[model samples]
Target: MRIRGLTVTFGEKRVLDGFSLDLPDQGVTALSGPSGCGKTTLLRVLAGLQRPEAGRVEGLKPEEAVLLFQENRLFPWRTVEQHLTDVAALSGGMARRLALVRALALGAQGCRWLLLDEPFTGVDQRRAEGLMEAVRGLRVPVLLCAHESHTLSLADRVVPLEGPPLRRREGEGP
Candidate 1:
């Protein structure tokens, strides 16, 4: 997918300014950056959850993209499975794994892009690694934001970002 000169502003704060990126057709790509640097914003744009003030994203349909947010976003009233208990009953790691699995399934099922925001937050290293392997197995493009170096290391490419007006690190963008 291609994002070119994308601009997104919140009141007076320009979260993204002339930002651009090109993602591979398939494989794992990680976005590594500090908090509040607009990584989530960029992901939202790609997922069509957030509308940018300016710019264009090519080759990705919002409906064809599924985003697993930083939070589990499981409902307290609905059961994910087993029907007896709601999703909130699951432990943090379990919830994260479930969410990741769901996202991967959607992505693999004819979806074009999968966006994950900090998907391994509560999961242990071993399980996280296994989950990373699952992410690598998907045929569609995968763009994820992760803070851990170990997690980033698993990606085919890692793009470092910085800014309220977010941009790629020096020599990192095309």
Candidate 2:
């Protein structure tokens, strides 16, 4: 996907100021950055959940991308077999893992891109790696946000970001 001159400003904080990025046609691409640096905002914009003030995203449709948010948004009452049950019954890490699995399953159905926002936040490193292996096997492309260096390393490409007016780190673009 190609994002050109994206500008999203929330009050006084300009989350994305003329930000642009080119996502590869295949494989996993991870966005690595500090907190409040617009990583989540960028993913939200890509998923069409948050509209940008300016710019356009090419080659991706809202319906074609599935966003797995930073928090596992599983319902507490629903019991979807082994993958999901009562939300209170599972640990934080277990919930996050289950959420990942569910998102992957949904994304595989017809989605073109799997956009994940810190999907491994509560999961351990070992288990996170295992989950990443599963992600790498997907036929569709992926754009995910990751804070851990190890997690970023698992991606085929990593885009390091910075600033309240988020921008790709100098000399770090594909």
For 75-105, candidate 2 gives per-residue lDDT tens digits of: 6555556443332367789888888988888
Which digits, one per residue and each the tens of the lDDT, describe model 1 over residues 1-174?
889999999999999999988888888899999999999999999889999989999999899898999987776555667322231478888888888887776777778888999999888889999998887777777899999987888888899998888988778745
TM-score of each: 0.91, 0.91
Whole-model Cα lDDT per candidate?
A: 0.86, 0.87
Ten contiguous residues minimizing lDDT sum, candidate 2: 79-88
The root-mean-square deviation over C-alpha atoms between each candidate and the true structure, in angstroms, is 2.4, 2.2
What is the overall TM-score of model 2 with all chains considered together?
0.91
Q: Which residue ranges in model 1 land beyond 4 Å of their true spot?
A: 82-87, 171-174
- Model 2 C-alpha lDDT versus the unseen true structure: 0.87
RMSD of 2: 2.2
